[model samples]
Target: MAETRSTTAPRVVRREPTLTGELLAEFAGTAILILFGVGVVAQVVAGQNGDDDSIHWAWGLGVTFGVYVAGRTSGAHLNPAVTVALAVFKGFAWRKVLPYSVAQLLGAFVAALIVRWVYADAIATVDPRTTFDSQGIFSTLPGAGVSIGTAFLDQVVGTALLVFLIFAVTELRATPPAANLAPFIIGLIVVAIGFAWGSNAGYAINPARDLGPRLASFLTGYSTAMREPGGQFYFWVPIVAPLIGGVLGGGLYRVLVERHLPDQTDAEQPTGRIPAEDD
Candidate 1:
């Protein structure tokens, strides 16, 4: 008699999406943004291979790709400023703000560490002393002859433009780009800010974008990472200014643009402020 043999296939289990998954998306998205943004700066400063335009384009593309990566999960708020703005105006759940910001910060920090690791030889060769100039590659710094007040104002304006444009393009009532095209347009907005506002304080415009890598540089022996060459405490400018700017921009868009637009009909109503997270 032939022996009976039975084989059971393994059961596959799928877990439902949760806040943790969203947070991981935020983390990875921000890390991707920093990886390209900082990598270009490193190439320019340490490797001596590129120029300002190269840095701008790389950072823009970084944002574009980062959004594409995390847009489906967390709406791709790769910047703390963006996260705060959404929480303030878009009903993004205030409880998630701190978590999202922390995830972004950690992502930037880890990406900066990785950038340093990858370009260790080049960075060491070019910036052996870890001076303020070298530190700028990791984080933003005031440009020559830029006052602290001017830097603050510059960040405010830059980030305001960022969040305002974000609202403009994402608002269902406004003339928004196609869903597939919004990320590229957002990236272009960053590039435009870099071109116009970068000279004052490197156009940080994003708190996590500045502070996370700044902390990394501090740990990696950049003594002036948290301060200016003149010994002024400069870190707060990027952080505080962007937060203020984000709210201002979002509010401005709501007041000046969104309110003026015709309300959506029932069939065309927007489900959420950001379409990416609606799913």
Candidate 2:
């Protein structure tokens, strides 16, 4: 039998944005976060420009802008703690976790470099005695009296509060804020965490936010960047503790609030947070 070709032309397949694009969004979102967040710290510590209030607002607004920048694309989970929590409890894909985390870390690292560059002269002048101690401008530092265990606990509690409140704010079934206010409420949570727990450990509630900038400071000549003032190898505390706390927070929120909700706005899909409208 002879084969014959069909007259119909082949249909074109439109290529969607790849993981690379998502990763870029994550990177950019996280960069925006660190740019303002760490920049405010530099302003306060180096230039004596503002106090704790400035830091709190700056970091909160940083998160807000970051989410706005990448929410549609990557969901703007600028913090690894948040990302992991979503994966565990909010239906985020597990496969993308590492990529998102690495991208966030890179963004934060690069932003720290930019902040250091911008404030080099001011930092040098701020403390004529030492440059390394200025690493706190880019990363977190525990208070003078806080021990390692105390700082770790502080980070856990702070991050747990952060993730838990995030779940609450984003919940679709519950009374989510009116008028797409999740991002703003999320920002406020960060501000609240800073105001409440910042004195204990500088409130490094996000692993990427803390570790990425700290890595930059270490690479750039801060000998004690990874260690605290009292010979404490405190670098891992934020990274590990936030991950733990975030998972705990998410789980706790699901158990405490989500399971109890009767509205079930997203009953079919059952995601804890609001599912994006169908494309």
- Best-matching candidate per TM-score: 1
For model 2, the run of ten residues with the poorest summed lDDT: 270-279
- Using lDDT, give the best candidate's number: 1
Candidate 1, after superposition: displacement of residue 259 in Å? 0.9
In terms of lDDT, model 1 sits at 0.89
Alpha carbon deviation, residue 243, candidate 1 (Å): 0.2
Q: In candidate 2, list every pair of residues with a backbone clash.
A: none
List runs of model 2 lying over 4 Å from the truth: 1-17, 128-132, 263-279
Against the reference, the lDDT scores of all candidates come to: 0.89, 0.84
RMSD of 1: 4.9
Give lDDT tens digits, candidate 2, residues 1-279.
Answer: 899999999999976557798899889999999999999999999988899999999999999888878776777889899889988887788888899999999999999999978888888897655454577897787898888898898889898999899888777666777535677877898999988889989998998899888988878768788888877788999999999999889889989988998754334433433522211
Predict model 2's lDDT versus the native: 0.84
